[model samples]
Target: MIPEDHFGSDAVATNRMHSAGVALEELLVTAQKQDCLTVGIYESAKLLIADPDSVVLCVLAVDNEEDVALQIHFTLLQAFCCDNGITILRVFGVRRLQRLLRGEGANRNLEEHGDFHCMLVTNPQADHCRLQEVDTYCQESRRMDQWIPELSLQER
Candidate 1:
């Protein structure tokens, strides 16, 4: 983490430094260790949605250390947060997740049929053009896990 004193409250910031894939992967692993099953990928979100009481925490792997696709992916997560059905966490890499999790090492609380379903996105570019609102975006994002994006937008 960068030193807090180095930043200005009024300034907008972007993470331009490209650390090896290790950092983001480490964070993912850490979050997972706390509630190991809190992560979801594939049809997992849909399955979680099926249960009225379940709270889905989504961690989207948008890169693999080559570079970070922060902005657009953040936009998508923002969209998910605005939606009632899912929660999104944008973590950078996938591999070191195990190590990071093991380092944090905590257990998750889940009922029967409860678990974290992590989808490691190795090829983010494959879905970029296909990811937008309407015919794209969540629709395509969920397809990786064999799911259809369930959008809930109705006139008030």
Candidate 2:
């Protein structure tokens, strides 16, 4: 799995999160306590948006100064932030990311930067290379025709 540092976020900050491989239900419970924003893709996010039990996106900015719940929520964010399936690039000041995605720039930049892992998968299973069969749930969901550019992680 690609680490969050590959995306260029504070790797140390993300690394500090303890993996709680407990259970989905337990995670959800922790999420609720932490007030995480649910980040969904395509239409799947609609269900999360409508549901009060959870938020709809992964990158949420809940204030953690008040208590540990929010901190726990952020911990979860940091956990998935480095997800190997996802390419969470660090966008400092440019909206050029849209262009990067629209073009095959992501793949090319990886080669140019010697950081190809930033855009393309390294040593993926033979099935992942096919693109069409790759599921959005896999994290690197760029293959599906349904993937909208807006849902893509863009930093302002």
Candidate 3:
């Protein structure tokens, strides 16, 4: 039988993770509304290279681990984000992210935007609460020795 303390700790961790996921989703939505979001691998990479200082956070969504090219891009992006002092968050479920960011009618833009794998949230016009939440979560994760901590955006 498991101890009650163990169950309490597990519950705390799960709640933290859920809050972090919600924070990420809200941050993305806010960025989109403010026109401070750069989506797609090429676009995000270009923005990161051209204006690294403007990028506040980098969110990577990977649905296919078997894709060699995608892995290479993620590796390079991780290096760049680290060098630039940008927070990087890895997430699962690209489709869920797309739906969250673009809504149900976003299929038309998919062809134009390529994929929702890589996204960069740039500096917004005003301070955002969700950004702070995500930043805190990242800081805590780092303190826990989790480099490039990942969160799932999929529905529970």
Compare the candidates by lDDT and give the number of the best one: 3
Off by over 4 Å in 2: 1-57, 85-156
For candidate 3, write residues 15-115 as lDDT tens digits. Answer: 88889999898888777767788899999988988999999999999877899999999999999999999999988878878777767433444436658
Ranking by lDDT: 3, 1, 2
Residue pairs of candidate 2 with colliding backbone atoms: 2-84, 37-57, 38-55, 38-56, 38-57, 39-56, 39-57, 110-116
RMSD of each: 15.5, 17.4, 2.2
TM-score of 1: 0.33
lDDT (Cα, tens digit) per residue for candidate 2, span 36-149: 312222222243234423222232222114547544544443344444233222212122322333343233322333211112122222222222212222243234332311
Model 3, position 140: C-alpha lDDT score: 89
lDDT of 1: 0.37
Q: How well does each candidate superpose onto the true structure, as a TM-score?
A: 0.33, 0.20, 0.90
Writing each residue's lDDT as its tens digit, candidate 1 over 1-156 gives 877766853142122112212333433443343332444343444544454234334445433434344444445444654475553434433333433343433332222222222432222223222112222334343565725332211111
- On the 0 to 100 scale, the lDDT of residue 102 in model 1 is 38
**Winner on TM-score (1 vs 2):** 1
Model-by-model lDDT, in order?
A: 0.37, 0.28, 0.84
User: Which prediction has the highest TM-score against the true structure?
Assistant: 3
